[model samples]
Target: MIEVENLTLRFGGLVAVNDLSLVVRPRTIHALIGPNGAGKSTTFNCISRLYRPTSGRIRVLGRDVSGLRPQDLAPLGVARTFQNLELFGGLSVLENVLIGAHVHCGGGLRERLAARPPAVIGHVEHLLERVGLAEFRHAQASALDFGRQKMLELARALAIRPRILLLDEPAAGLRNREIGALDRLLNELVERDGLTVLLVEHVMQLVMAISHRVTVMNFGARIAEGTPAEVRRDPLVVEAYLGQEAAHA
Candidate 1:
């Protein structure tokens, strides 16, 4: 559903992404894995139109989006969650999700909340339940535990009803149980809802267990691309990111 070709982004002398190219097929989960400074997030920024690339093209849903503004992406069915939590601390979980829904719901925040349109309300409630935060919907975002907060962010992203979801490290700060829950939720999204996902995550088990394809990167460029099993056994991927122990595991 997304294609990036010969993409490069330079910050003066620092080349954050260099000639990177990859494809995310429709209705599947793709993982982008690499070391800390491997430019995964930088590539995401370019795809999301948060950063303009120095060269090359980005196509989403078959249209070249290289010149579109960030706001332009949502209308084109794109949504994402950040590596760090971006929830509004003071807003209730419901309110935060409502903000995301505003793109589709079309009303002032107070109007939407007070009227609680059946279509919008039902969608938001379903997302809350999907993320296991239905009970916390009325609570302040800051009041939830970290794992719940992550789930809340996921709900907000889904509020847009995006065709393609770009998740930046969704498994970064969670207990094993929480990670397991996330794994199941992601699979369900792709299988049941037909949502295409491109996630950048460091959790090897999560990536290997769910991803249809894996692309390995280092120093801002792709070093390997294949299925999860194929990537795990690549010698360069083992040395550069996964390590020998992880490769063996």
Candidate 2:
């Protein structure tokens, strides 16, 4: 559903992503993994149009994404969550998720200010329930614990009704139980809802358990791309992580 061809991103003398290429198939979970500074996040930014590539091409569902703004991608069925939480702390959970529905809203500011349609209000309630935050719909975003806050973020992203989801380290800093819940949520997203996922994560346990394919990078270049088992046994992949011991530290 997403393709990056010979992608390169450079900042003056610094090359963050160097001719990296990968394809994420529809209805599948594809993982991009590497030690720090390996350019996983850079590649994600390119796909999300937060950063334009210095060279090469990115295609989403066969349409080239060049020149498209980040907001443009959302209407085309793309949604993403940041590695860090990006919720509005002062807003109620329901209000924060309603912000994501702006792409689907047809009315102008005046209409919105007048009131939300019943359908829109119901949709937000459903989303809160789906993310296990039904009772917290009126709770302040900052009042929720960290794990619930993350789920709130996920609910907001789902409010976009995306065909493809890009997640950057969704498992980071979560408790084991929270990660397990996330894993199940992801499985349902793909297996039941048919959402394609492209994830950049350091949690090998989550990546290997959930991803159908894994791509490993080192120094801004792809070193291995294959099934989780294949990547786990790859000599170069092993070397890349072990050589940096910093990966685990």
Q: Please list the residue runs of candidate 1 whose C-alpha ends up more than 4 Å from where it truly belongs after superposition.
A: 107-115
What's the lDDT for residue 218 in model 2?
92
- RMSD (CA, Å), candidate 2 to true, equals 2.6
Per-model lDDT = 0.93, 0.89
Worst 10 residues of 1 by lDDT: 107-116
lDDT tens string, model 1, 1-249?
A: 999999999999999999999999999999999999999999999999999999999999999997799988998889999999999989999988988887777667776556667788889999999999999999999999999999999999999999999999999989999999999999999999999999999999899999999999999999999999899999999999898899889
Q: What is the lDDT, from 0 to 100, of the residue 72 in candidate 2?
A: 92
Instruction: Judge candidate 2 against the unseen true structure and give its global Cα lDDT, from 0 to 1.
Output: 0.89
Off by over 4 Å in 2: 106-115, 242-249
TM for every model, in the order presented, reads 0.97, 0.94
